[model samples]
Target: MLTITATLRCQGGHEDVLRDALLDVARHVAAHEPDTIGFFVSQDLADPCIFTTYERFADQAAMDRHNTSAALARCFATISPILDGDVVLLTGTELSAKT
Candidate 1:
């Protein structure tokens, strides 16, 4: 299994817009990508500007396909301008899981 975690900080006054865009992306993934096992999005309690996305895929190929998806491109276009800084990505192979 492959896991990808990303952190994005929205520019001032753009938190709601970014959150909506991310939700759209999540919906797209759920509707189009069966290989995507999980997609989770959450906002920071203390800092509304900070958002995190946790994505799990069946394998590297699944992740790669997701990266090249039109849905992801749409998401990038929507979030790029409102982003405060470069996105932070963390990736790894799942070692163990209970779920």
Candidate 2:
């Protein structure tokens, strides 16, 4: 499995935009991409402006399709202006998991 972790910070007041975009696209991804095994999103309790998304894909091809998907593109366009700085992204091959 291919796993992706993305951490982003919003520009203080744009939390709604970030939240909305992420929520909307997450729904889209869930409904449209079957190969995307898991899609999870979270916000930091201590830091309101910080958020993270964890995604698991079946393989590289599945990840590629997701990266090129239109919903994700739209999400990026919507949130681009509100981003505080460069997003931190990490990728890995899943060694093991409970579920």
Candidate 3:
């Protein structure tokens, strides 16, 4: 399995917009990307403008498909202007999972 984690920090006034956009992306992935094993989005209680995501893919091919997906491109297009900085990301092979 392949997995990825991402952190996004929104510009102060755009927290709701960024939150909704990320949720929409998760919904789109759930409906369209069967090979995406999981997609989890989270918001920080201490910092409303901060968000994190954890995603699991069946394999590298699934990850590649997601990387090139139009939905993802659109998401970036929508969020880029409001982001405080570049999204932080880490991708790696999954050695274990809780479920």
- lDDT per residue as tens, model 1, 26-49: 999899999999999999999999
Residue pairs with backbone overlap in model 2: none
State the lDDT of candidate 2 residue by residue for 1-99, as single tens digits.
Answer: 999999999999999899999998799888999999999999999988999999999999999999899999999999999999999999999999888
TM-score of 2: 0.97
**After superposing candidate 2, which stretches have Cα over 4 Å from the reference?**
none
Alpha carbon lDDT of residue 30, candidate 1?
A: 92
- TM-scores for candidates 1 onward, in order: 0.95, 0.97, 0.95
Q: Considering TM-score, where higher is better, how would the candidates rank from best to worst?
A: 2, 3, 1
Writing each residue's lDDT as its tens digit, candidate 3 over 1-99 gives 899999999999999889888888899899999999999999999999999999999998999998898888888999999999889999988899899
RMSD in order of candidates = 0.9, 0.7, 0.8
Give the best candidate by TM-score.
Answer: 2
